[model samples]
Target: MASDPEDRAAAQRELASLKFAQAQDKAKQDPAAAEKLVRESLTLAPGDEKAVDLLGRVIHAQGRLDEAIQVLGEGDGKSCDMCKRYLSVLLLERAGKREAAKDFEGARTDYSRATELIPDATTALAVARSSEQLGDLEGMTRAIEKAVPLIRPEDTAAQTEFLGFRERTVLAAAGRGDVATCDRWLNFFPPGAGGDGWYVLQLRVAQELYRQKKVDVAVTRARTMLGSTHTDTLPANRKTEFQRFLADIYRLQGVGYLREGKLAEADDNFRLAMEFLPGDDKIKLLRALAIGGHHETEKALQVVKALPKETKGHAEVMAILESMQVADRLAEGDVEGPRPRSRAQAASAETPEVHVAMAEILFITPAAGVNKGIVRQLKKSGIVKYPNDEVNRYGEALSELAWAREQARGLGEGYLFRGPGIDARMANLDRQLRAFTRSRSSSTPTARRS
Candidate 1:
């Protein structure tokens, strides 16, 4: 649209007003207001590069990212190359067109051209990320090749940004399942390079090794990183990431123990897994372990209660907790006298089903009294059939115990039983006790001799 003289002067006044409004909007963190001002500025001077840039930023900040890209593209060739590079990345990333459109490579070209126009380390890092994304390993190597030479050794920003580029290159290599390339990148890390990046990279390497089934190597690498005295020096975000990695390690360790039938060790690892995961994730693990009679069910519930109501798994945990509470009230009714729980009591009954469940989960030991009677019966009779099957019998009994424990954890009526399982030794002892009492009362000579 062509502008008349008066129309052009009025447009200038509107542009000036919006410039003031933009500052006010930013100060208030009012994205809506900022967007409105930028849009009005663009309307007043439709082809104004500054107006387009400001509007594009406001739109991107508001997450109307596609619209931002369209607005920014108007100034794509005219704006400073640095601005174009940033805008291109936002466009490519928000469009989810990274590899599909080969935009990362285009971004690399822009950054490379920018360096020819103005040499800078930030541009070098951008080029490195772009090359890594494009699977141009040698290009990545070359992009950062200039970085170290350009950087003064003591330049913290350059060093930090270079480390960032190196870390990303490692991640890209790992993503491509190119462990050899990742190792080559690791060689560049300085000997004393202790930071958020080092521990994270170590954990990533360990994870890759674990994925390759190099279990012992993975364990050693994880422990070495975790046990480092400087772990405390890591940033909060990095420490959270480290804790998540530890949780994953513990989960794998738990699976190993569980497969070997080592219930105690499995339970320990799973409990540690819950401790490091977020509340929602922790509850899921707790529910699974609670069904298996791990001892941390009650503690897990307490932790879930502490989470914000908006947490992802909150509703599910609350439902399970409510069902458990009802079951507890039902079980306690006969033992604690005929009393109905009040609504408030029902809601917050911290009853101890999980505690009792844990106590009862252990293998039931045949006490001395029971064993003595069984041995006596075995010695006296032709009733001991299939004597070689004792170990098999014990295993069957333990399996039954495991099933009962699973049921008693309130796994619903599907697992609950109508009757107690048969205990062969106890049954034999009962039968022999009845026969011995009858003989003793009849003045049997065997009882008198004893």
Candidate 2:
């Protein structure tokens, strides 16, 4: 025991300071080596909060985050808000490591804890991204919503960036027809304060509402978006996006309902579709079918009756009129409904995905074959799958599938309804039928070989 207590106290402070300074210098060049100096500094003067925090960081720099967190926690016991919030950064960095490892669940947990502690934009974004990786869409939306208040009201760029992330997720989910996921995201960004995000989300909401057969709600949402004076970041060409996208939804629903023999519903949907695509002949034909199928013979007749005389004389119009007559005649007897599933309906079971992800990540650079982006963009532009593309570079897989299917269908009736030339043959027959009927009366069907 040194008889001088003052000397012992003075020695402890001096050593602690010297060791802490050395630790800082070493940390810049060699974090692992700095760990030793930082530990020594903490021991020289017990409960040195700064030394504890520094030691945590030094260890953390060496990728020992668990230990870093434990070490910092001890200091945090005596520290105030300053160092406590710093811990959230440590947590976020660690979560990134876990995310890189595809330990998404662990990353989500870490981000959740960090965001709960900090409740700020940085941590909230971490939470949202981690949740997206985990496919916890609800969690992702919740995290993004939590970030809204933290964003500066004047930072439109920041607001767009955050909402852009959500939009990607929303559109991707909707493109896959993941209705549950789309609807969950729609719960946020209703009208008001959200600005661009809210307007964009409404587009998806209306699309999904139509998919769900909530036609009125979907139409209302579309009309509201069309009417919104609020501007968004999308290009002006996309101004009619709500109407165009809703038209697609209505057409899809009309096709599905027509297949299901829900003629009345299909009629309404097709009518809604014409509001956006007034010239869509397929929509008009389908609406007539819907009316006739629903037993509205007069309404079904009225559709064809309303067509121009030249149009009424077209084969397509006559066919629809024939369908109406069949419905009227069948009014007296039981007519077997079509099978539970129809080919048209089967197509809508999943939304059409125009272009799949080029690479697992948006950009992948390897010193090898054609870049995935090139392939993806080519496919997106409909340049892939050409007869000349396969066996050379891109679209080899798709070409193989097409060739195999073509070869198999040639082998039997299983593919009787599908093939390359069958469409042309069908079209030829349709043309002949239309040509033959171009001069006939609406009541002058039943042409025979007499």
Candidate 3:
């Protein structure tokens, strides 16, 4: 009676299919018209997967990405493979536009969604790029990992590009002290894939670790690389550079140990450093400092004196000599007056002799006792001569020690007299200075006496 219900349903389905076919043919040449036809087809058969896919494509072609995405999303509930493929493509296109506009956040959103849909190398790489722009190192690394497996063997260009990206990521990680990330990426490359550049990268990572003050870790990493057979494959210049880098690391460690009063360890590291950087006078000076740290003033003095008179660190060496002489004079209870005809008194001397003398006095003075004669000599040294200077006598002494320490550090000699003995003495002087400051603030100043 109702015009045959079955026949009516069949007619609607046939008409919908016919409209969808027409829409597909016109999709490329006239997307606007194609969109209208697909919409009419969907009106007749509301949930047709093919019809919905065609509508999305036509809408995307007409540059209505948001509408197209909305239309395509309708078929997702039906698990339409074709719809998902089209949607992923549309998303990639939109992502590209966003990226071109420098809207990386929007681009990242689209790229990430597309990656979840297709899991293809191209989309994954796009996600990686966007993540990099956002400073998302973890996201960038994850995307790269996803892409590497998807890359086809025949796609040599893609593989090379991935490797290059990985190399940059590793270096960036190293620079930021992300040791674990650097290690993971480094192991991703097969043996010999990174060539000599690989070894250089390792050295750079170790150097960065050192700069960040992770000294023990840096030493271990550098030592491991130094012992690797792969090192022999490096070019001569690169090998030399690596060797020198290792030497520098050892020297730095030696200086650290020397400053901490670990004489045996300091001497051992310095010797190891000398093996790589043979005849390095800086290392020799460091060894001498180690001797001095152990209170072997004569041995330290002889080592310094043995250096050529025209050494670049002549000023530092002279300071060391003065420091030792002061120590010797203090030990002999000879602080009655300044030593006669000393190198510091010479007209040609350029060393900060006053600072050196004060540093030595501070280095040798026990925490429980203060030498009045040394105090008188310090006052007479004129370290507190500036009227406008706010620091008292003890503060001036500490300042001189600090200046000497900085000079030594700049010359790669480590902090001068940073051993426990000197540290204790300096701490004691600091306490006294604080006490003196409080007293001066609350009471009349004592008469100035030398």
TM-score of each: 0.33, 0.48, 0.63
lDDT of 3 by residue, 159-191 (tens): 676777777887888788899999977765522
**Mind giving the per-residue lDDT tens digits that candidate 1 earns over 1-450?**
246776877768676566746744673487778777766665666666565666667777787876776666654534543356556556445534443566886677666755544566666766777887877879988877765566665668777777877777788776666767776776664323456667678678777777777766666666655566656676677666666776777766665554344657766777877777754364353344343333333564576566676755354444434334433444455334432223213432232222222222211223334455566565455233323212113334334444534544454432211111112322332353345345434454554565
Q: Please identify which of the two predictions, 1 or 2, would achieve the higher lDDT against the true structure.
A: 2
Give the better candidate number (2 or 3) by TM-score.
3
Q: What's model 1's lDDT at 257?
A: 59
Better of 2 and 3 by lDDT: 3
Best by TM-score: 3
Mind giving the per-residue lDDT tens digits that candidate 2 earns over 255-299?
666645565676688788899878866566556655556556467
Worst 10 residues of 1 by lDDT: 414-423
Off by over 4 Å in 1: 1-134, 142-146, 153-164, 186-194, 201-217, 229-232, 236-244, 259-450
Best-to-worst ranking by TM-score: 3, 2, 1
Off by over 4 Å in 3: 1-21, 36-52, 75-78, 100-105, 132-138, 151-178, 181-204, 229-242, 256-262, 289-311, 314-348, 352-450
Question: What lDDT would each prediction earn against the true structure?
Answer: 0.55, 0.58, 0.70
Q: Which of candidates 1 and 3 reaches a greater lDDT?
A: 3
